[model samples]
Target chain A: MTNKLAKLIFYLGTLISLVLFLALTFDTHRQIQTLTHADQLSEQVVAGKRVWHKYNCNDCHTILGFGSYYGPDMTKVYWRRGSEGIKAVIRSPEKFTTWRKMPRLPLTDKELEDLVAFLQWTSEIDTQGWPPQDQKLRGAPGRAVTLGVSPGAVLFQEKGCFACHRLYGTGGQQGPELTHVGSRLSYETIEKVLTDPRSTNPQATMPPPMVSHEERDRLAAFLAGMK
Target chain B: MLLAYSSQRVAYPYFLVALLLFLLQVVVGTWLALSYAVTMPQWLVDILPFSTTRAIHTNLLVLWLLLGFMGTTYFMIPEETEREIFSPLLAYLQLTLLVGTGVTAIVGFLLGWTKGKPLLEIPFPLDYLVVAGALIFLFNVGMTVIQAKQWTLIQGSLFGGLVFLAVMYLFNLPFYANLSIDWYYWWWVIHLWVEGAWELVAAALTAWILIKITNVPRELVEKWLYVELGLFLFTGIAGTGHHYYWLGAPKYWLWVGGFFSALEPLPILLMVLDAWHYIRNRRAGLNGRLIFTLAVGMSILHFVGAGFWGFAHTLPQINYYTHGSQVTVAHGHLAFFGAYVLLNIMSFYYAMPRLEGLAEFDERRGTLAFWWMSITMMLMTLAFSVAGVLQTYVERVMGLGYMTAQAQMRFWFAILVVLGLSLLGGVILTVVDLLTLRPALAGAKKA
Candidate 1:
């Protein structure tokens, strides 16, 4: 029994030594930029991260391909949507999307700005080749000097049609895919469906959004761009 | 049968509930597997999302195994201490509260009331109930040990595991501040409990099985038990580095994590090889040789599935490519089945039928289930391994998007679904046999 106890002690000591080794490695691996100097998140950006967690965003979205596969990868979302686009969608998402999906968490201006910063910060992480081109928009070089988030794209997500309809085979499955919607529908029919779904299909469950004629036009042009 | 009558009585409630929940866990797991192979409807996806499915599959696994651990304690402690449990009434009450709260939480998850931490998604209020349940359990078992002042090595090891499990669970109580730090601490809870504490349970249980059936001297068996405990502490603690590689932690973890975790399999390898030699060379436990042989076989499977496949992905360089890929899924399935699933089943095999007063412990239906379940799980692991590697190459190496990569691996995922269903079938049969045998024992006037 004493011999076995001695062997046990010897093994425990060896294990404790490895723990120290792991700690030593942790200290050496600290990022100089984040831990030491100017690379830290600004006070607002830090608050935005808190907002991200507060709503349990990771439940629906993958950051670096770790979380749920329900929503799009948010690793480079800042680049995909831009600052203005993110704000418009978050501000009054119900006015923008189709389904009651992606809950509208009412955020103050400061919280919105912080969330954008937080997203921008995440976009800068060295994700090691995550979220290939499908998630990003690679338009022609004629549009090289890029602009803010497109209002159409914001409306598409905000209005929740994406929840019911697939775009290039990504969203929920109830409705026809919007990826080839432009090829199948003329501009007038697209407008008609947006303004009044029952006019196009008598059994359609879609409730027409209360947006004005101009917003309806913009939404039509957005659906037209899907092809 | 050698245990105090009270010990045997307390054990029945725990084993019965655990087996029923085990069936529920397998059914949910089969659903998650089938969803990957078929196109689930959009509205259905919205209601029972893949995340919800995955959460239910994984959490049910943890809950049922935890239930089994309590069963393990109730069954083993009295035998080890040579005394009856302090209170059988508390044991029954504890099972009702634990299983009731667990079922409620599972229902809550379906309705989308989750905190959304993967594997730890049992919400806040349920966490309190779990704590209360564990404490009540610990008190009942602790009271028994206090009443009987004799302490055995097997009981000591098991008690250590239970205490550590309760303590580690409290790590989830606090709200973490940063995502990286949150994940960093999360792995400590996950890795330590799986690789550290539960190992003590495995060792004690394996030791108990070997001691009862075999002619191995108590001195020799106890000495090896110490060695298993020592090795577990050595590897499981430092082996947690494998999880820290990409969590934005230190760079040296690449080497430190990979190297130490690579060594984690050494003890399992030793335990299996030792058991194999004893079984082949000597017929010490032939009276109940069938279950004894299976218990040995599971140790080998644990070594290969958890130990071997785990090392395959632990290397920092390999993980850099395979992180979050199907490869990790493959590892998780094999490791979990080989380690915890096999270990728990072996415990039930030892305790339940004997308690049911079967004239002979080796029933043909159960033996068939064991072989069927083990074979199908290995095939499923193979399917997962091939699919994961292909996914990493196509998605990470070729820079394809997630869905496109999933499309490329469709064939393997189909195989996985088929094998998963077969394995589920085997589990159902085994659980049914366990259920019916209890009544058979009662009718025979054995209890």
Candidate 2:
């Protein structure tokens, strides 16, 4: 009777071991699939990474919740700007004529393209609408935003608008208010104002033509809807 | 050879230089503050030379503090290590390099070779040389520690403080073309070195000075020293978080920045409490100007003013408005002047009598200068804080532009200018007391 009992216990232990092995194999297969789920980065994106690392860009400027807090966040840079506009700005920082100036570095064409690619990847990474401050023109008759775009809004944040301009009730007072910019100007006029902002007034302190066409339209619409 | 009495020989020269530097810093700083009030007066602008003056004010504060520290370290290291300083010649060389590099950097800044960065404003290649000088000093001190078998807790704190100061400085490199990035890392170097590491050194220095000067028990002083260092390490790391409140960081940082920064005062409080405990128990009747007392008091004030101001704006909600405003200047003034500068002054007093083998000097003069300087600095900080608040309300909250706000607050700015002049007067008085008056011991030595 004792011999029979021993044989039954041995058989049960073997069965349990086989079942555990099968379960481990299944779990390993699932982990492998999950690990491969992320898409492979293209060559352009890889090149951009090289430039970013070489410059130690991450040491100061944060992107997509990475890098240091020493400079302005660049996560939404691409969404706010297009490829050609960013290219121009990178080539000649004269595009960004503001009080807070970024010194022009001697970057090669290849390096600039890679940096832009990095910026492009940054702009698309779902920030959940961060840094969403608006721009308002003081004492303007109307606002100019229309067509589901907020040109003035984009203009405010992008131009470091808060540095000199204020929305509804906040920001520096060095410049005029722009809350009513959309109502005061048509889309084409807004475009003209953007290209040569000083054309409206010779002594105007405003900088000229920093936005691309699509961004200008979108930003104008956002401002128009502000009312 | 240990300077049993040779310290007296070096006393007058150091005091003279330190006093002159102090007075010059105060005058320049006051003039600059007044210019903001007076709408940038042409004569004042030309005389003060804003760009160069700013550099001088900051650099003088740094240099004087360093001179004091080195002088004290030269005396204290050998005593604690139970051996003479590794090389007195090297010590002098380090001082020469520091002064030489410092003068060149200041001149370069005036010529507009400024990296346009504060604190780390020196042109690129020179910065490396400064680092090299620091390494040489570190080597001398490190070798001295190894030769001496006596490695006390105080020595450990001092060594740790120096190492961290050097490490903090290494990160001040210009990795980005953006000036803001440069400023950010500059503060990391300056703030961490002064606010953080300096506090640790202060605790160690206070313990050693008190033990030597008074009847305080060595064991008790050592115990408090460890306690103070604990507080420093806990708060210092988190204290640097205050500088991160702005600079386009994520909002979540407000939690770490604000909460941890609030604790920065604890170490300083411990320092003050420990000093008081020692004084209370001592039987020496506290001879001389009680310079150590003033040093401890100033260190505590540093914690209150710099650390508190840091807490005030560290919250994202608050920093979003106060960033780059005069409130920052208020904090800067108190933190740098109140803590490190005052401690240096006190250290000078302690070392001066000992080095010169002079009789105890009049405590009344030092006590008076201490009170005058501390009070005036506190008042100046208050003025800046008030002006800063008004600026924030008018410029940010009220949605007025920068020019309009500046135009509106011309009167307050004028008052600040006048207040700044008073601060300069305080500096003059302190320098006079420190430099001109010799104790009876000096006469005895000459006789």
Candidate 3:
């Protein structure tokens, strides 16, 4: 091709693409408020975003699939770990130690609340089904029931119990392996330990189990049946 | 044997600093890989947490690459414009400001000061210094090109790319209340800079090097440069959509991103063909075998890593499963190494001998370093890919928790750590060869 033709192609192609990109960007801006629930972007959520930056959280954790891969993606974190779970971990990351530990940051109560609020806002944004839900976890309880897995097994996965405690050959090493917990503790003792770990051993670092009495019973039975 | 212009010597320090920073980047990166494979000591973790170390690693990559680009510009512009640099003193000042800012940023990150965005984590105040440095660089180069008033297509493209790069950084400086809005513009800086601006820069540099090495007619090389970069901007600007698909953008982005990004590989393919065509039709015997090999190697891996590996997961359907997983990491390592890193190293190999006024130099050690670095990087990419695939299957597909999935991928991470150490050895070899290789004597045969 001649220089003039090549230059024309260069200018025209770049111009066309730039124009299209800007048009899409403009339309995206128009629809963004509704898509992201801009009305719900509270002061606390903004403060939480500041907290996120102040602590350099994105350096480890990804939000909206952006940032480093050192920590887990925090887009759906509000759904994965509830507000209380998030607050607990932030308040004392040492207590939630696992294979991949989150470093402890000295966040105040207000920062903790704000960060959770920001995460909540992020969870609510429509990601267009990005980070596709795990096929097994989609209707896990029902699938477990069909597969003859106990409700307690489903709760174990849902409550993220396996994050700290291992069963069989899988899971974290932070807590003792529970492959044969049924052989050691009766259902009553297991339930007591789940309800109040500090009662069983005052040195127990496990926080009080965040479950209803029925969930506690189901988990105890599941562990009791593991022998 | 001497450089065509004395002002070209200004690039020597830029290249030296870039390589030094490159070594530091690899060190931090290897440490990160080790941390992933095995738990680091608690005291070490308390002092240099993964977050701090990771920030340092990525920021170092950016800093080194920028230095490389600036050096390449300084070296090439004098030849292209047929004049001295507009202001060599200003160039040195820019370098000092940038390096100072980088050192301070690393120390600040350790002291708990950051803006917290990945890659853009060079705290708020230091960012201004970066912007100022960029402005100074632009002014100096802009004046050089403007005063020459004899613009070749290569010089024009190079200037355009530099200006575009500087302009894009403005996007990262703002804060948005909405996270979606935040990321939308964030991609403007991150995605657009890589796919759009940096591609332009790489294209010009590659074309300039090919013209110099092959003794090809300027018209012929510049023609291909125009066509290739034209196609690049055509596909790349909209290819920004691929990043938009999952970041709370409109659903239409899924289609836009998928369609445009699929075409993104075409220009890169064209680039490879363009280089091959010029290399095959060269008029003279090949000189600087190591530099030629690196240039050719850059083209091949650029196609494989950025073009092929990028296309591997650019589709929304595949990306949905792989986004934020090890799959992205796999693509990232290969793409950056193949595209930008090799380009910089190639420039160093091409320019260093001439900058030192050597007619020829022993190249065996350089060649050995080349193979070592390239092969190890390819292997590391493979290790990360295997781990990514397994992680996706276990964590995303099987619904395992993050730690459980990570447990399964430890074997691959172990492989990565070993490969990273090997890569470090290669880097050390390169540094040694660059520093210690002596000039060949007159009447001696080139290696």
- Please name the candidate that would achieve the greatest TM-score relative to the true structure: 3
Q: Report the C-alpha lDDT of model 2 over A1-227, residue by residue, as the tens digit.
A: 24344334334433443354344334523442332221334567657755664544443344442333223445545543445445665565444433222335457988888778766654543222333321133211133233223445545454444454445654445456656666777766666666677777777765554567776766556554544
Kindly give the stretch of ten consecutive residues in candidate 3 chain B with the minimal lDDT sum: B438-447
User: Which regions of candidate 2 are displaced past 4 Å?
Assistant: A1-143, A147-227, B1-16, B41-52, B177-187, B248-252, B440-447
Candidate ordering by TM-score (highest first)? 3, 1, 2
RMSD of each: 6.8, 12.5, 4.2
Better of 2 and 3 by TM-score: 3
lDDT of 2 by residue, B321-356 (tens): 666566767887787776777777777777765665
lDDT digits (tens) for residues B1-447 of candidate 3: 469999999999999999999999999999899889887765666667899999999999999999999999999999989999999999999999999999999999889888888899987889989999999999999999999999888887788988889899998888888999999888888888889889999999999988888988999888878888888998999889998888878999999899889998888998888888888898877665787788888888888888998999999888888888887888888889989999998888888888877767888788898899999999988888988898788877766677777888888898888898899999988887776667765554653
**lDDT tens digits by residue: candidate 3, A177-221:** 877888998988899899999878898877776789899899888
Candidates' lDDT values, in order?
0.71, 0.61, 0.85
| Candidate 3 off by > 4 Å | A134-195, A198-205, A209-227, B441-447
Model 1, runs deviating above 4 Å? A1-18, A21-119, A125-227, B1-3, B281-286, B438-447
CA displacement after TM-score superposition, residue B287 of candidate 3 (Å)? 2.3
List the DockQ of the predictions in order: 0.16, 0.04, 0.52
Assess the local accuracy of residue B35 in candidate 3 as a C-alpha lDDT between 0 and 100: 87
Which of the numbered candidates is closest to the native, going by highest DockQ? 3
Backbone clashes for every candidate come to 9, 40, 0
Candidate 2 chain A has its poorest 10 consecutive residues by lDDT at A133-142
Which window of ten consecutive residues has the lowest lDDT sum in model 2 chain B? B1-10
